[model samples]
Target chain A: MNNIKELLKEQIKFTDGYLDKYLAEKDNPQNIIYKAMRYSVFAGGKRLRPILMMNTCKMCGGDVNEVIPFACALEMIHTYSLIHDDLPAMDNDDLRRGMPTSHIKFGEATAILAGDALLNKAFEVVSQYNGNNPQRAIKAMNMLAVSSGTEGMIGGQIVDMESEGKDITLDELKYLHLNKTGAIIRSACTVGALMGGASDGEIKAVDEFAQNLGVAFQIQDDILDVTGDEKELGKPIGSDAEENKNTYVKLVGLEKSKELAKEYSEKAKKSLEMFGEKAEFLINLTDYLIDRKF
Target chain B: MNNIKELLKEQIKFTDGYLDKYLAEKDNPQNIIYKAMRYSVFAGGKRLRPILMMNTCKMCGGDVNEVIPFACALEMIHTYSLIHDDLPAMDNDDLRRGMPTSHIKFGEATAILAGDALLNKAFEVVSQYNGNNPQRAIKAMNMLAVSSGTEGMIGGQIVDMESEGKDITLDELKYLHLNKTGAIIRSACTVGALMGGASDGEIKAVDEFAQNLGVAFQIQDDILDVTGDEKELGKPIGSDAEENKNTYVKLVGLEKSKELAKEYSEKAKKSLEMFGEKAEFLINLTDYLIDRKF
Candidate 1:
């Protein structure tokens, strides 16, 4: 709804469609699982996470072009999660962005293998990155591992699955949302800071901003499930209610959840205060996360 | 058998559960997937593959302890594949080494998640080896990525699933088996060479040894399916035959499969000629892979 459209355009322009040319080499790099991996990775999404990462880097004095592979790597990890989460054994959703999900189009085995390949390749891409400092690469890689591994998003998923259709405390719900959604969001910011060679204090501020923003993002999703238009959301409205999922609105009232989301959005914006006027995009993004219909 | 057992003992001693204190802090690392991952990885097994790696590194003039993490990493990948392969949707097995399969012991969801965690953690372990020679670490990591990714083992898995109960050419069968079994086996040897600073000639020889040895290993399993005693094998004999799976003995006669195994065994031994007597452990390991009953 703002200047992000242009930024998104520039980022997605560089991200999509090029992978196939690389895959179409004389050696037939375009193998079946690679095709499946590439299909989901290149599938048309907003590329919001990568754009946020790149723009944040540029704002903090890093070359966005130099960080392109990492941006692609983040997209790869994000896409891998979507692929796995759509498996029959996992989230089991058949539709994504109005097209059949990866498992639905490719067989289940290929879908599983595609996720596996993407995850392995992500580290490969990051390893290829000879950043200005090796220690920073090590820290960034460690951040990614924790964010994606059992201790972070995966841990959150396990707890969420166990809590489904059951009463969960607000504390547990917050922990789940923070680890599940906030972990990656925070990781994207941390990656930007590392690439940009930010000071430790600046990195801490970014982490706080991301964490607050992530809560608002999930809270907005809860609001959307109850109020959003199906066509706009591209899925069933009230589906969360139907699933009996433990959510912000379910635990607290809808009014309270909305208030909480606003509180988080404000705190997110507050974390960007030190950047003065250069943090407009982040501030706007925080507001947009809680304000959007979907 | 005479010298190999002694070497196995020596190699195992080099690893010596020495990381117990550091890993203990991280061990049972507080999440279901983390706990399950440790259970699958650190739980007692033959340690045969890691031992092979250690001995090969020693034979090539590398520090055995320096390569220990890679040795552990290789086993993690192997364990992960085994765990996933036994899932209900995959091999659907219930027993491994006379114990419940990973999917049977943990629920399918946890089993799947556990495998996913281990695979991710394997790369995490490898990426941490940023020694003085970052280039060697990079080369080793890239080799690992290719060997483990879509173009290698997972591709084989996809083809193996698609071709189950279908007729296939011998070349196709070899391709499938080579990738499914041979890729990591080849990796085990090459990783050792990479650690040891082996010449290209040395690396090539070890690679040849690994490939032929891989064929022998798979052929031995095929032979064991029909001829091995159940007691020794710790499971039902003739299992592959009962599944109507395509195996070497099924395509060619039993005698020919045995002859092929012998030929491959000879080739493997000859590949080690450059290293002369120093490769005795690897030579013995090759013999053990082709000649063992279970």
Candidate 2:
């Protein structure tokens, strides 16, 4: 466990360095957008998505350098989504990661443009990839686009928005999380696998692992919302209940949500069995996720 | 002039057909987003960008089929920009092209998501390009991303947003319009030339033509906003004045703005001299843009 923690710390540091390089600020009139983008990107994210991608690539015996650009691009997409999600028109979140949201810090218009710029930058970065295998880079780019697009994250977001304050079935909740969080998480692993030259079966296995892990991660988030330290979580608890959101903890009791999270976590780990000792870190990461307090 | 108009009409039809096919709606719960995207896309505006792209490809002796996907994607990017520009937090416009804006038709959240989905769809469509020239396609894709990103459209938008209601200088207004309206227009031409397999010299000529034409088009827009008929323009005139926007007309008097538009139009045509008679269509198109009532 301690070894995994140390590895995660190092991975986060490495990912952040790449992110900073790719998203470096410019000295121009429109630098405000750059500042706004870097603000949200560097706002102390756990860098889970990029870390997952890099590790997946390494585990598949792929060159980390080839995967680095896509990993950073994925993180940028994730950051852009969060920035847009916290807009006044959407979630209206004022505080994220213990800091004022992008819109709150920089007026609504700049924040929106910053989100847009980041999304555009993601593709820009991927398109600039001059790897030996251009086809694989193109494939990874498409996966990132499709997963973050209407049929994936946006679809989940719309459903989640519509289902607010309504009684949604468990199936509906599952669909929501699967698209919203699951799609991007799945894309991270699959894109990394593709970059690493994984076969179809290996890609499928990683997809399954990511899908289950995404759901478990969301379930843990819901459970933490109900019973989490405000200081550790960096936001007030019960906000989900306050918003009347249809979270896992809301549909099921807290104890049941925890049990389901563990079940999904176990399933996630089970999907990685084919990788054997090579996937030990991912397996441990799954355990850490379900057991995380923050 | 009539021949040019006929060609424009046919090009718009062809482009719209491809766009409809690419953005076809699925019978699913999240189909609302598709509907919203199609709504704004099919809205009755001149498909100038796509038309320019297809024509540029044809003039360069490249296959129009290869450029069709990119043409559609460029239009999608343009549409998404309009959707975002009309948001309540931004321009707050209620009507566009004589119809309710996306945010007015659909709610704010859906409008934002629809914009995002369209942007993602642009990249998704481009990534699916299976032309023989994968390198050229990648180059075009990168051009699209950079031109529409912070260094291009978004950069222009931020500067425009910041300069609102401020007494800005002529150079500032030019910079704003160049980045805002100019980047995407220039991208349309340059990407087409690249995909059409134009030589570097030809691409350079097209870039210069587009840079001048973009400014001419924007200047003409400013002039129409003050002097043209509202029914012909499809929206109320004087909105720029009402918003205190730093338009070319506002910075330079109306007559000088018109002169500037004509001067830029002439320069645009001048740059196309290398193609001689083959560039007649684009030259006429330039005249049409500057002389447009809308």
Candidate 3:
């Protein structure tokens, strides 16, 4: 567990550097929005998405440098979503990662533009990848755009917002989680595999691994919302219930949700059997993510 | 003027069909956001950006069919910007194109998400374009992303928001309008030329033409707000002053603003002189856009 923690910290630092290099505030004359973007991005995120992408790339024996732009792009997309999600018209949250949310620090309009800028910059960063495999880069970019769009994250957001304080079916809940969180996670692994030149079968396996891991990750989030410590979690606990959001914990109870999370985690781990020792880090990372309290 | 109006009406109808095909509501399981996206997109927009792109492509001897997806993507991006700009936190606009603005027709959250979806989907549509020149498509996408991002439209929006009700220099006003309106308009021309396989020199000329046209178009907008009829304009006039926005008319007075607009329009038309008769439609379109009542 400690080894996994060390790896996670190291990867986070590396991704932070890449993010700063790509989106440094000095390059932009419109400094305030850039500053706001940097604020949320450098706000001590776990860097789980980029790290997952990097590790999957490594597992497939690909050069990490080639995919760093794409990896950083995923993180930017994630950060933008968080900024918008915390807006007054959305979740209306005040704190994120133990710091003032973007809107709380900057004004709402600046925050909104910051989010928009980050999303646009994410595509800009990937589009600048003049790699040996421009075709692969274009493919990865297309998948990233699709996963972050209406059929994916934004679509899930609409459903989630509409379902608030209302009865939602288990299938509806699954649909929301799959698109909201699952889509990007799946894209992260798939892009990593594509950058690494993985075969179709191998890419399919990575997709399966990420799909289960994404659901398990959300289930853990639900569990933590019910039982997390605010000091460790950064934000306050019980926000999910306060928002009247449907969750795995809400539908299946704590113990059953825990069991389900474990099931999904196991499924994710099993998906790595084809990679054998090369996927050891991924297998351990799954356990670590499922065991996370924050 | 009547001939240009007929051409404009024909172009709008063509773009409307393309928008409907690309963003049809029935295609997505998340039906509400899709419906919201379609509503604002079909809200009687002038289709200026896409029409500019298509016409430039035609002037470059490029197949309009090959660039229609890119043309439509530009419109989607334009629509998304308008949707977000109309948010209560931003402009708080109640009406657009004589219809209720996005947030008025849909709820604020849905409107925001719909804007986000449209932005992402714009890139998706362009990415799926299987043109003969993949490199050109990628280059055009990069330019599109940059123009619509921090250094372009969003950047302009930030300054405009911050400068409201405050004394601003003509240079600052120029900078604001350049980014807020100029970036996308210039991109529409540049991308069209790129898709049409224009030479570097030709692309440069188109860029200059578009830049002058963009500034002229904005000045015309300012002039219209001060003096044009509300009925023909669809929305009420003089809302710029009500919003305390700084405009060319505010800085230079209506007569000077009109003269400046004419100067830019002439410059834009002159840039296309190298194309001889091939530029006839573009020259006429430039005049029509600058002389628009709506």
Candidate 4:
């Protein structure tokens, strides 16, 4: 814990190895989509969701290896969502994490298919989980599926699309972010809780913790879009405003948005009071998430 | 049974009822994607995949009702694939089943989200199957996920995209169809067998039956594209040629393609000899599939 950055780096490296195992290079006839999918998945991210899941499971006294496949699946789903969000029909972003977007590298059609394949493969990987608790594995898979489906991520996406360039209520904006980003993040925690065999009370506590953290994470993102350096952020700032998308920073002034993020982060940290010192990593992670320069 | 057409109609009706039950209209915030999903699913192209699943389950002495949720999930996945395939960057077809394509009916972004939602929801539905055999349900769900994933349908699709306007060999064409159209259709049967508590041997036989039927089904589609009437087919005739796609008809002459379909159909029927008269409906369905004018 002396060097949180080093700890995060180690977690990412471990997750990358697991992901590489799941997405090994193939030379089959249909290797094009696999290659494209592997490209986006291996395109570096913080692996925040998966690291959180594995850490939460470990904190709950569950064997981390049992949840490794599921953690990898979560990362794949996140990567696929990013790939789809960058499509020409969606946000149409050309760059992600300082690299060409999936549609920018592969053609749009192949990119779309690659995203589809990754999403399908996420479920395939989770369904193959041979952990000691089959029931909990199914439950974790179910939570992940619902969190990323129409009622969750996709639902939020459609609303975001419909609300683009149009004025939306603060509640509407919150609803959009809650589904588009919050649901999957929340699912990451809940699935980990289930896999870790957490007590019902602990599971509920983690859910609340994850939900608040997820919303706070998005608010920090909004803040970063205004204050983040392009070199560090790896993408242009002010694109959200340019796109006329409603965000916390746009709805409230920067100062008020920062205050809101702090409040949510505090609430996220407070939700872990049930775990005492065992929640140190999660509590520190929330602060780092909010205070990061990028 | 008398009138295989009537039997097919009854099966479609049953599957439709089950689908409607699963896809109940919701007034939630993300209702837009749900509406788009329901529209494509109900657009109707003969509930062939779901029917094959249900029939396969019944033929193996399993209760059809036990696999209803999964059968509906199969249709949802099939409908989602069609929606994505009809996008502007893909086949760019405006009409499917005589109705405007999903992206035409809904905007492109919403259509894409709708397809993503459907795919996710398919897994959610199957994962919620509280049937008598939880282990089998997980296995069936895994099979469906894998079958429609990069190694299966999407794999076929990427190759199909790359092969466009290129002169591909007959073997290449078969590989594409075996994945693109063949995988899910085959999954419908394999999943059914797994759910129906079939023996390993029985499941293998049904898998072989489905593989043959899926290929034959695609060959019939090729034949229909070249020789069938648009009024009966719903979609335009010669559209495959219009797209410069390599099809069975394009590689082999129409007569040869038709003969190949017949050969596969006979093989499909022969594979079902293991089930004796219990597979009557499936056997008749194979003939109907090959002999279908629409």
DockQ of each: 0.47, 0.81, 0.73, 0.80
DockQ of the two-chain complex in candidate 4: 0.80
Query: Judged by DockQ relative to the true structure, which candidate is superior, 2 or 3?
Result: 2
| Regions of model 3 farther than 4 Å from truth | A27-29, B27-29
Per-residue C-alpha lDDT of model 1 across residues A1-294, encoded as one tens digit per residue: 567657557668876644343333224222677778878976777776677777677767787766666666777778887887788877789998778899899877678777877887777677675645665666676677678776677767777766778888999899898877678788888788778777888888888888888888899999999989888888888888898988899889899999999999999899878888879888877776677875
Give me the overall lDDT of model 1. 0.77
Best by TM-score: 2
Pull out the clashing pairs in model 1.
none
Per-candidate iRMS values, in order, are 2.7, 0.8, 1.2, 1.1
Candidate 4 lDDT by residue in tens digits, A32-92: 7778988998887889999889888877878788888888988888888999999988888
The model with the greater lDDT, 2 or 4, is 2
Query: What's the TM-score of every candidate structure?
Result: 0.92, 0.98, 0.97, 0.98
Candidate 3 interface RMSD (Å): 1.2
Q: Which ten residues in a row have the lowest lDDT in candidate 1 chain A?
A: A21-30
Off by over 4 Å in 4: none
Off by over 4 Å in 2: none
lDDT, model 3, position B141: 87
> Which model scores highest in lDDT?
2
lDDT of 1 by residue, B1-294 (tens): 867767667666655474242123343223566666766666556676677677778888888766777777777777888887887767888888888887788777678777877777766676666577666665676676667766667767877987899988888889998887788888888888888888898999989988888888888889888899998888898788889899999999799999999999999899999998899778878887787887
lDDT, ranked from best to worst: 2, 3, 4, 1
Q: Model 4 clash pairs?
A: none
